[model samples]
Target: MTTPGHLYLVPAPLDFGCAVQSPLTDALPDATLRAAAGITHWICENAKSARAYLKRIDAIHPLATTIQAQNIVELPREVHKKGDHHGGFDARPLLAAALQGHDVGLLSEAGMPAVADPGSSVVRAAHDLGLAVKPLVGPVSLLLALAASGLNGQNFAFVGYLPQDATERTDRIRALESIALRTGQTQLFIETPYRNAALLQALVASLQPNARLSVSWGLTLPDGRTRSADVKTWKRTPAGPDNQTPAVFAIGR
Candidate 1:
Protein backbone atom coordinates (compact mmCIF):
# COMPACT_ATOMS: atom_id res chain seq x y z
CA MET A 1 0.00 0.00 0.00
CA THR A 2 1.27 3.50 -0.80
CA THR A 3 2.37 5.50 2.22
CA PRO A 4 -0.22 8.11 3.23
CA GLY A 5 0.51 11.82 2.90
CA HIS A 6 2.04 13.67 5.84
CA LEU A 7 0.62 17.02 6.87
CA TYR A 8 -1.51 20.14 6.51
CA LEU A 9 -0.47 23.78 6.90
CA VAL A 10 -3.55 25.46 8.26
CA PRO A 11 -3.74 29.24 8.51
CA ALA A 12 -5.51 30.55 11.63
CA PRO A 13 -7.31 33.78 10.85
CA LEU A 14 -4.96 36.61 11.86
CA ASP A 15 -7.08 38.01 14.67
CA PHE A 16 -9.32 35.11 15.58
CA GLY A 17 -11.21 34.31 18.81
CA CYS A 18 -12.08 37.61 20.39
CA ALA A 19 -15.26 39.34 21.42
CA VAL A 20 -15.38 41.04 18.03
CA GLN A 21 -12.63 39.03 16.29
CA SER A 22 -13.39 36.28 13.77
CA PRO A 23 -12.51 32.80 15.00
CA LEU A 24 -10.42 30.69 12.61
CA THR A 25 -10.16 27.68 14.90
CA ASP A 26 -13.77 26.81 14.17
CA ALA A 27 -13.04 27.12 10.46
CA LEU A 28 -9.83 25.01 10.27
CA PRO A 29 -10.16 22.60 7.35
CA ASP A 30 -10.44 19.52 9.53
CA ALA A 31 -13.64 18.15 7.99
CA THR A 32 -11.90 17.27 4.72
CA LEU A 33 -9.27 15.67 6.89
CA ARG A 34 -11.72 13.80 9.13
CA ALA A 35 -13.05 11.95 6.03
CA ALA A 36 -9.97 9.72 6.08
CA ALA A 37 -9.96 8.09 9.47
CA GLY A 38 -7.51 5.52 10.68
CA ILE A 39 -6.43 7.62 13.63
CA THR A 40 -6.55 11.41 13.50
CA HIS A 41 -3.33 13.07 14.64
CA TRP A 42 -2.01 16.62 14.62
CA ILE A 43 1.49 18.01 15.13
CA CYS A 44 1.34 21.69 15.91
CA GLU A 45 4.24 24.14 15.80
CA ASN A 46 3.27 25.45 19.23
CA ALA A 47 1.99 22.47 21.15
CA LYS A 48 0.83 24.63 24.04
CA SER A 49 -1.22 27.23 22.16
CA ALA A 50 -2.65 24.66 19.76
CA ARG A 51 -4.22 22.77 22.64
CA ALA A 52 -5.68 25.93 24.13
CA TYR A 53 -7.05 27.20 20.82
CA LEU A 54 -8.76 23.90 20.06
CA LYS A 55 -10.11 23.56 23.59
CA ARG A 56 -11.77 26.96 23.23
CA ILE A 57 -14.07 25.38 20.62
CA ASP A 58 -14.85 22.04 22.35
CA ALA A 59 -12.36 20.23 20.10
CA ILE A 60 -9.90 17.99 21.90
CA HIS A 61 -6.67 17.07 20.12
CA PRO A 62 -4.65 13.96 20.88
CA LEU A 63 -1.73 15.72 22.45
CA ALA A 64 -0.69 12.86 24.74
CA THR A 65 -0.89 10.05 22.19
CA THR A 66 0.87 12.10 19.54
CA ILE A 67 3.72 14.27 20.85
CA GLN A 68 2.90 13.43 24.48
CA ALA A 69 2.78 9.63 24.38
CA GLN A 70 5.76 9.73 21.98
CA ASN A 71 3.85 7.53 19.54
CA ILE A 72 4.17 9.51 16.31
CA VAL A 73 7.32 10.51 14.46
CA GLU A 74 8.87 13.83 15.38
CA LEU A 75 11.00 16.31 13.39
CA PRO A 76 14.03 17.18 15.44
CA ARG A 77 15.12 20.81 15.71
CA GLU A 78 18.80 19.98 15.07
CA VAL A 79 18.02 19.37 11.40
CA HIS A 80 16.83 22.94 10.92
CA LYS A 81 19.13 24.59 13.48
CA LYS A 82 22.16 23.13 11.69
CA GLY A 83 20.60 22.95 8.26
CA ASP A 84 20.65 25.35 5.30
CA HIS A 85 18.27 27.99 6.71
CA HIS A 86 20.14 27.91 10.02
CA GLY A 87 18.61 29.72 13.01
CA GLY A 88 15.83 31.01 10.81
CA PHE A 89 14.19 27.63 11.36
CA ASP A 90 14.82 27.56 15.09
CA ALA A 91 11.37 28.98 15.80
CA ARG A 92 9.92 26.15 13.71
CA PRO A 93 9.63 23.15 16.00
CA LEU A 94 8.80 20.33 13.59
CA LEU A 95 11.18 19.83 10.69
CA ALA A 96 10.76 16.46 8.95
CA ALA A 97 7.59 14.72 10.08
CA ALA A 98 7.19 11.14 8.89
CA LEU A 99 4.21 9.81 6.97
CA GLN A 100 2.16 7.19 8.84
CA GLY A 101 -0.93 7.11 6.64
CA HIS A 102 -2.03 9.93 8.93
CA ASP A 103 -2.23 13.70 8.66
CA VAL A 104 -0.07 16.21 10.52
CA GLY A 105 -0.74 19.89 11.07
CA LEU A 106 1.90 22.61 10.81
CA LEU A 107 0.92 25.84 12.51
CA SER A 108 2.41 29.07 13.90
CA GLU A 109 2.45 30.91 17.20
CA ALA A 110 -0.17 33.23 15.71
CA GLY A 111 -1.80 33.66 12.34
CA MET A 112 -0.25 31.61 9.52
CA PRO A 113 2.99 29.75 9.40
CA ALA A 114 5.91 30.40 7.00
CA VAL A 115 4.70 33.92 6.27
CA ALA A 116 6.88 35.61 8.90
CA ASP A 117 7.55 32.66 11.21
CA PRO A 118 9.88 29.64 11.14
CA GLY A 119 7.28 27.13 9.87
CA SER A 120 8.80 27.31 6.39
CA SER A 121 11.13 24.37 7.10
CA VAL A 122 8.23 22.04 7.78
CA VAL A 123 6.40 23.13 4.62
CA ARG A 124 9.54 22.81 2.48
CA ALA A 125 10.36 19.41 3.92
CA ALA A 126 6.81 18.19 3.35
CA HIS A 127 7.12 19.16 -0.32
CA ASP A 128 10.42 17.31 -0.62
CA LEU A 129 8.82 14.23 0.91
CA GLY A 130 5.89 14.49 -1.54
CA LEU A 131 3.41 15.23 1.24
CA ALA A 132 0.30 17.32 0.71
CA VAL A 133 0.56 20.76 2.28
CA LYS A 134 -2.74 22.60 2.47
CA PRO A 135 -3.52 26.01 3.94
CA LEU A 136 -6.64 28.08 4.72
CA VAL A 137 -7.27 31.74 5.42
CA GLY A 138 -5.49 32.86 8.60
CA PRO A 139 -4.81 35.97 10.60
CA VAL A 140 -1.54 37.62 9.60
CA SER A 141 0.11 40.44 11.49
CA LEU A 142 1.44 42.02 8.29
CA LEU A 143 -1.86 42.53 6.53
CA LEU A 144 -3.69 43.21 9.79
CA ALA A 145 -1.34 46.05 10.63
CA LEU A 146 -1.47 47.38 7.09
CA ALA A 147 -5.25 47.24 6.87
CA ALA A 148 -5.60 49.05 10.19
CA SER A 149 -2.74 51.43 9.50
CA GLY A 150 -4.72 52.87 6.60
CA LEU A 151 -1.55 53.31 4.59
CA ASN A 152 -1.21 52.59 0.88
CA GLY A 153 -1.45 48.83 1.33
CA GLN A 154 -1.93 48.40 -2.44
CA ASN A 155 1.87 48.79 -2.82
CA PHE A 156 3.72 47.88 0.32
CA ALA A 157 6.58 45.69 1.46
CA PHE A 158 7.27 44.08 4.83
CA VAL A 159 10.93 44.82 5.52
CA GLY A 160 11.27 42.31 8.34
CA TYR A 161 13.93 43.84 10.60
CA LEU A 162 16.44 46.62 10.72
CA PRO A 163 20.18 46.53 11.31
CA GLN A 164 21.69 45.96 14.78
CA ASP A 165 24.18 48.77 14.93
CA ALA A 166 22.68 52.11 15.90
CA THR A 167 24.30 54.01 13.03
CA GLU A 168 23.55 51.36 10.41
CA ARG A 169 20.02 51.01 11.70
CA THR A 170 19.57 54.76 11.54
CA ASP A 171 20.76 54.78 7.93
CA ARG A 172 18.35 52.00 7.06
CA ILE A 173 15.56 53.97 8.68
CA ARG A 174 16.51 57.03 6.61
CA ALA A 175 16.45 54.95 3.45
CA LEU A 176 13.02 53.55 4.29
CA GLU A 177 11.77 57.05 5.10
CA SER A 178 12.99 58.31 1.75
CA ILE A 179 11.28 55.45 -0.05
CA ALA A 180 8.00 56.11 1.75
CA LEU A 181 8.14 59.82 1.03
CA ARG A 182 9.20 59.58 -2.59
CA THR A 183 7.33 56.57 -3.88
CA GLY A 184 4.33 56.61 -1.56
CA GLN A 185 5.05 52.96 -0.94
CA THR A 186 4.17 52.03 2.62
CA GLN A 187 7.29 50.93 4.49
CA LEU A 188 6.48 48.54 7.30
CA PHE A 189 8.96 47.08 9.77
CA ILE A 190 9.08 45.53 13.23
CA GLU A 191 11.54 45.74 16.08
CA THR A 192 12.18 44.09 19.40
CA PRO A 193 9.70 45.17 22.06
CA TYR A 194 12.39 46.69 24.23
CA ARG A 195 13.52 48.95 21.41
CA ASN A 196 10.01 50.06 20.41
CA ALA A 197 10.29 53.32 22.29
CA ALA A 198 13.64 54.12 20.77
CA LEU A 199 12.40 53.18 17.33
CA LEU A 200 9.35 55.39 17.74
CA GLN A 201 11.55 58.30 18.77
CA ALA A 202 13.79 57.74 15.77
CA LEU A 203 10.79 57.61 13.48
CA VAL A 204 9.41 60.83 14.86
CA ALA A 205 12.79 62.51 14.34
CA SER A 206 13.82 61.04 10.99
CA LEU A 207 10.60 60.71 9.01
CA GLN A 208 9.46 63.84 7.12
CA PRO A 209 7.55 66.15 9.42
CA ASN A 210 4.46 65.88 7.27
CA ALA A 211 4.79 62.18 6.47
CA ARG A 212 1.97 59.95 7.65
CA LEU A 213 2.92 57.49 10.41
CA SER A 214 0.81 54.76 11.92
CA VAL A 215 1.79 52.62 14.87
CA SER A 216 -0.39 49.59 15.35
CA TRP A 217 0.25 48.44 18.91
CA GLY A 218 -1.16 45.41 20.70
CA LEU A 219 -3.37 44.58 17.76
CA THR A 220 -6.19 42.06 18.16
CA LEU A 221 -5.76 41.97 21.90
CA PRO A 222 -7.55 43.42 24.89
CA ASP A 223 -5.24 46.45 24.85
CA GLY A 224 -5.02 46.65 21.09
CA ARG A 225 -4.40 50.22 19.97
CA THR A 226 -3.59 51.90 16.68
CA ARG A 227 -2.08 55.38 16.50
CA SER A 228 -2.06 57.13 13.13
CA ALA A 229 -1.01 60.71 12.65
CA ASP A 230 1.65 62.93 11.10
CA VAL A 231 5.22 62.47 12.28
CA LYS A 232 5.24 66.05 13.48
CA THR A 233 2.29 65.47 15.78
CA TRP A 234 3.82 62.25 17.06
CA LYS A 235 7.00 64.12 17.86
CA ARG A 236 5.17 66.65 19.93
CA THR A 237 3.13 64.08 21.83
CA PRO A 238 4.59 62.75 25.08
CA ALA A 239 3.50 59.21 24.37
CA GLY A 240 6.76 57.33 24.45
CA PRO A 241 8.22 58.05 27.86
CA ASP A 242 9.19 54.42 27.40
CA ASN A 243 6.44 53.19 25.10
CA GLN A 244 8.05 49.78 25.00
CA THR A 245 5.00 48.04 23.62
CA PRO A 246 4.73 45.38 20.93
CA ALA A 247 3.71 47.22 17.80
CA VAL A 248 3.98 47.44 13.99
CA PHE A 249 5.12 50.86 12.75
CA ALA A 250 4.42 52.09 9.24
CA ILE A 251 5.58 55.18 7.43
CA GLY A 252 4.41 56.59 4.09
CA ARG A 253 3.84 59.86 2.29
Candidate 2:
Protein backbone atom coordinates (compact mmCIF):
# COMPACT_ATOMS: atom_id res chain seq x y z
CA MET A 1 0.00 0.00 0.00
CA THR A 2 2.96 2.31 0.63
CA THR A 3 4.25 4.12 -2.43
CA PRO A 4 7.58 2.66 -3.53
CA GLY A 5 8.55 6.05 -5.01
CA HIS A 6 8.83 7.60 -1.58
CA LEU A 7 12.40 8.53 -0.55
CA TYR A 8 13.79 8.65 2.96
CA LEU A 9 16.79 10.84 3.63
CA VAL A 10 18.33 9.19 6.64
CA PRO A 11 21.10 10.54 8.86
CA ALA A 12 23.58 8.13 10.47
CA PRO A 13 24.81 9.02 13.92
CA LEU A 14 28.44 9.92 14.61
CA ASP A 15 29.39 7.11 16.99
CA PHE A 16 29.59 3.33 17.17
CA GLY A 17 28.83 1.95 20.64
CA CYS A 18 31.24 4.70 21.56
CA ALA A 19 33.73 2.38 19.80
CA VAL A 20 37.17 2.96 18.30
CA GLN A 21 36.09 3.35 14.65
CA SER A 22 32.51 4.25 13.70
CA PRO A 23 32.15 2.40 10.45
CA LEU A 24 29.13 2.45 8.12
CA THR A 25 27.77 -0.69 9.84
CA ASP A 26 27.78 1.22 13.08
CA ALA A 27 25.80 4.02 11.46
CA LEU A 28 23.33 1.83 9.56
CA PRO A 29 21.70 0.27 12.64
CA ASP A 30 19.19 3.10 12.96
CA ALA A 31 18.31 3.11 9.25
CA THR A 32 17.97 -0.67 9.08
CA LEU A 33 15.91 -0.74 12.23
CA ARG A 34 13.68 2.03 10.89
CA ALA A 35 13.33 0.24 7.56
CA ALA A 36 10.77 -1.84 9.46
CA ALA A 37 12.39 -5.23 8.71
CA GLY A 38 11.96 -4.37 4.95
CA ILE A 39 13.62 -2.18 2.39
CA THR A 40 14.06 -1.84 -1.36
CA HIS A 41 16.15 1.28 -1.94
CA TRP A 42 19.11 3.08 -0.29
CA ILE A 43 21.57 5.54 -1.80
CA CYS A 44 24.88 5.70 0.04
CA GLU A 45 27.58 8.33 -0.18
CA ASN A 46 30.24 5.67 -0.56
CA ALA A 47 29.86 2.37 -2.44
CA LYS A 48 32.23 0.44 -0.19
CA SER A 49 30.39 1.41 2.99
CA ALA A 50 27.03 0.25 1.64
CA ARG A 51 28.45 -3.12 0.55
CA ALA A 52 30.13 -3.60 3.92
CA TYR A 53 26.89 -2.67 5.68
CA LEU A 54 24.85 -5.27 3.79
CA LYS A 55 27.30 -8.00 4.75
CA ARG A 56 26.71 -7.42 8.49
CA ILE A 57 22.96 -6.61 8.69
CA ASP A 58 20.60 -9.55 8.13
CA ALA A 59 17.91 -7.94 5.96
CA ILE A 60 14.48 -9.63 5.69
CA HIS A 61 13.29 -11.18 2.42
CA PRO A 62 11.04 -9.56 -0.27
CA LEU A 63 10.63 -6.24 1.47
CA ALA A 64 13.88 -7.13 3.25
CA THR A 65 16.65 -8.62 1.10
CA THR A 66 15.21 -7.03 -2.01
CA ILE A 67 16.14 -3.65 -0.54
CA GLN A 68 18.98 -2.49 -2.71
CA ALA A 69 21.55 0.02 -1.53
CA GLN A 70 22.72 1.71 -4.70
CA ASN A 71 26.11 3.38 -4.56
CA ILE A 72 25.59 7.03 -5.64
CA VAL A 73 29.26 7.90 -5.88
CA GLU A 74 29.09 9.23 -9.43
CA LEU A 75 26.16 11.45 -8.48
CA PRO A 76 28.37 13.37 -6.11
CA ARG A 77 31.35 13.00 -8.42
CA GLU A 78 29.56 15.29 -10.89
CA VAL A 79 30.12 18.02 -8.31
CA HIS A 80 33.01 16.55 -6.29
CA LYS A 81 35.68 18.86 -7.63
CA LYS A 82 37.01 21.55 -5.30
CA GLY A 83 35.71 25.19 -5.33
CA ASP A 84 32.41 24.14 -6.93
CA HIS A 85 31.05 22.67 -3.70
CA HIS A 86 28.40 25.39 -3.16
CA GLY A 87 26.08 22.53 -4.28
CA GLY A 88 22.58 22.41 -5.93
CA PHE A 89 24.37 21.96 -9.25
CA ASP A 90 23.60 18.29 -10.06
CA ALA A 91 20.31 16.34 -9.85
CA ARG A 92 20.62 13.31 -12.13
CA PRO A 93 20.66 10.50 -9.53
CA LEU A 94 18.15 12.25 -7.35
CA LEU A 95 15.95 12.38 -10.45
CA ALA A 96 16.70 8.81 -11.55
CA ALA A 97 16.31 7.42 -8.05
CA ALA A 98 13.02 9.25 -7.63
CA LEU A 99 11.73 8.24 -11.06
CA GLN A 100 12.37 4.61 -10.14
CA GLY A 101 9.68 5.03 -7.45
CA HIS A 102 11.95 3.61 -4.75
CA ASP A 103 11.75 5.11 -1.26
CA VAL A 104 15.39 6.14 -1.32
CA GLY A 105 17.39 7.25 1.66
CA LEU A 106 20.34 9.53 0.89
CA LEU A 107 23.16 8.89 3.34
CA SER A 108 26.57 10.43 3.71
CA GLU A 109 29.81 8.65 4.43
CA ALA A 110 29.93 9.83 8.04
CA GLY A 111 27.73 12.60 9.35
CA MET A 112 24.32 13.99 8.35
CA PRO A 113 24.11 14.79 4.69
CA ALA A 114 23.47 18.25 3.12
CA VAL A 115 24.87 20.29 5.99
CA ALA A 116 28.45 19.97 4.84
CA ASP A 117 28.03 16.69 3.01
CA PRO A 118 27.18 15.69 -0.59
CA GLY A 119 23.59 14.56 0.01
CA SER A 120 22.22 18.06 -0.55
CA SER A 121 22.05 17.46 -4.28
CA VAL A 122 19.84 14.43 -3.85
CA VAL A 123 17.71 16.30 -1.33
CA ARG A 124 17.15 19.16 -3.75
CA ALA A 125 16.31 16.79 -6.57
CA ALA A 126 13.82 14.99 -4.39
CA HIS A 127 12.18 18.32 -3.68
CA ASP A 128 11.91 19.08 -7.36
CA LEU A 129 10.47 15.62 -8.09
CA GLY A 130 7.78 16.13 -5.43
CA LEU A 131 8.92 13.01 -3.62
CA ALA A 132 8.90 12.81 0.14
CA VAL A 133 12.43 12.94 1.61
CA LYS A 134 12.26 11.70 5.17
CA PRO A 135 15.21 12.69 7.34
CA LEU A 136 16.47 10.33 10.05
CA VAL A 137 18.05 12.50 12.75
CA GLY A 138 21.75 11.87 13.47
CA PRO A 139 25.13 13.42 14.34
CA VAL A 140 26.63 16.47 12.65
CA SER A 141 30.31 17.47 12.65
CA LEU A 142 29.70 21.23 12.49
CA LEU A 143 27.59 21.30 15.63
CA LEU A 144 29.93 18.79 17.31
CA ALA A 145 32.91 21.10 16.85
CA LEU A 146 30.94 24.22 17.76
CA ALA A 147 29.66 22.88 21.08
CA ALA A 148 33.16 21.78 22.09
CA SER A 149 34.92 24.94 20.89
CA GLY A 150 33.79 26.98 23.93
CA LEU A 151 33.08 29.82 21.50
CA ASN A 152 29.82 31.71 21.09
CA GLY A 153 27.56 29.21 19.36
CA GLN A 154 24.73 31.71 18.87
CA ASN A 155 26.08 32.36 15.35
CA PHE A 156 28.49 30.43 13.15
CA ALA A 157 29.21 29.41 9.58
CA PHE A 158 30.34 25.95 8.54
CA VAL A 159 32.69 26.42 5.58
CA GLY A 160 33.28 22.73 5.08
CA TYR A 161 36.80 22.00 3.72
CA LEU A 162 39.19 24.93 3.47
CA PRO A 163 41.14 25.76 0.36
CA GLN A 164 44.16 23.55 -0.22
CA ASP A 165 46.32 26.01 -2.10
CA ALA A 166 48.47 28.17 0.15
CA THR A 167 47.82 31.60 -1.37
CA GLU A 168 44.08 31.15 -1.88
CA ARG A 169 43.62 29.61 1.55
CA THR A 170 45.54 32.43 3.15
CA ASP A 171 43.46 35.03 1.36
CA ARG A 172 40.26 33.33 2.37
CA ILE A 173 41.46 33.15 5.98
CA ARG A 174 42.26 36.86 5.94
CA ALA A 175 38.70 37.65 4.88
CA LEU A 176 37.20 35.25 7.42
CA GLU A 177 39.43 36.58 10.19
CA SER A 178 38.13 40.07 9.59
CA ILE A 179 34.55 38.78 9.63
CA ALA A 180 35.12 36.79 12.82
CA LEU A 181 36.66 39.79 14.48
CA ARG A 182 33.81 42.07 13.48
CA THR A 183 30.84 39.72 13.80
CA GLY A 184 32.18 37.54 16.65
CA GLN A 185 30.82 34.57 14.72
CA THR A 186 32.84 31.35 14.79
CA GLN A 187 34.45 30.36 11.49
CA LEU A 188 34.69 26.59 11.30
CA PHE A 189 36.16 24.50 8.52
CA ILE A 190 38.23 21.35 7.93
CA GLU A 191 41.37 20.37 6.07
CA THR A 192 42.65 17.08 4.76
CA PRO A 193 43.77 14.72 7.54
CA TYR A 194 47.47 14.91 6.86
CA ARG A 195 47.43 18.67 6.31
CA ASN A 196 46.25 19.45 9.82
CA ALA A 197 49.55 20.98 10.79
CA ALA A 198 49.66 23.09 7.66
CA LEU A 199 46.12 24.45 8.09
CA LEU A 200 46.89 25.28 11.72
CA GLN A 201 50.01 27.08 10.63
CA ALA A 202 47.96 29.06 8.12
CA LEU A 203 45.50 30.06 10.81
CA VAL A 204 48.33 31.30 13.00
CA ALA A 205 49.85 33.30 10.19
CA SER A 206 46.58 34.80 8.89
CA LEU A 207 44.52 35.47 12.01
CA GLN A 208 45.29 38.19 14.51
CA PRO A 209 47.40 37.35 17.53
CA ASN A 210 44.53 38.18 19.88
CA ALA A 211 41.98 36.17 17.92
CA ARG A 212 40.80 32.95 19.56
CA LEU A 213 41.21 29.64 17.75
CA SER A 214 39.46 26.42 18.64
CA VAL A 215 41.11 23.31 17.24
CA SER A 216 38.96 20.23 17.62
CA TRP A 217 40.32 16.93 16.29
CA GLY A 218 38.81 13.43 16.39
CA LEU A 219 35.49 14.61 17.64
CA THR A 220 33.16 12.12 19.36
CA LEU A 221 35.64 9.28 19.03
CA PRO A 222 38.37 7.63 21.01
CA ASP A 223 41.47 9.83 21.27
CA GLY A 224 39.15 12.80 20.68
CA ARG A 225 40.78 16.08 21.65
CA THR A 226 39.62 19.71 21.66
CA ARG A 227 41.52 22.83 22.59
CA SER A 228 40.52 26.51 22.65
CA ALA A 229 43.46 28.83 23.00
CA ASP A 230 44.55 32.28 21.94
CA VAL A 231 45.93 32.39 18.41
CA LYS A 232 49.22 33.79 19.77
CA THR A 233 49.73 30.93 22.22
CA TRP A 234 48.51 28.28 19.82
CA LYS A 235 50.84 29.52 17.13
CA ARG A 236 53.94 29.95 19.28
CA THR A 237 53.52 26.37 20.48
CA PRO A 238 51.35 24.18 18.27
CA ALA A 239 50.57 20.77 19.74
CA GLY A 240 47.45 18.60 19.80
CA PRO A 241 45.98 15.28 18.72
CA ASP A 242 47.19 13.43 15.62
CA ASN A 243 44.68 12.01 13.14
CA GLN A 244 45.05 10.02 9.92
CA THR A 245 41.59 10.60 8.37
CA PRO A 246 38.19 12.19 9.03
CA ALA A 247 39.06 15.36 10.97
CA VAL A 248 37.39 18.69 11.87
CA PHE A 249 38.75 22.21 12.59
CA ALA A 250 37.17 25.47 13.81
CA ILE A 251 38.52 28.96 14.45
CA GLY A 252 36.87 31.99 16.03
CA ARG A 253 37.71 35.53 16.99
Measured by lDDT, the strongest candidate is: 2
RMSD of each: 5.2, 4.0
What TM-score number comes out for model 1?
Answer: 0.72
Clashing pairs counted in every model: 8, 7
lDDT of 1 by residue, 182-237 (tens): 89999988776678887877778767788888888656555677778888888788
Writing each residue's lDDT as its tens digit, candidate 2 over 100-136 gives: 6656656665667666766676676777777877766
Consecutive 10-residue window with the lowest summed lDDT within model 1? 31-40
The models' CA-based lDDT, in order, is: 0.62, 0.65
Q: TM-scores across all candidates?
A: 0.72, 0.80
Candidate topping TM-score: 2
Residue 202 miss distance in model 2 (angstroms) = 1.6
Off by over 4 Å in 2: 1-4, 13-19, 22-33, 54-63, 66-76, 82-100
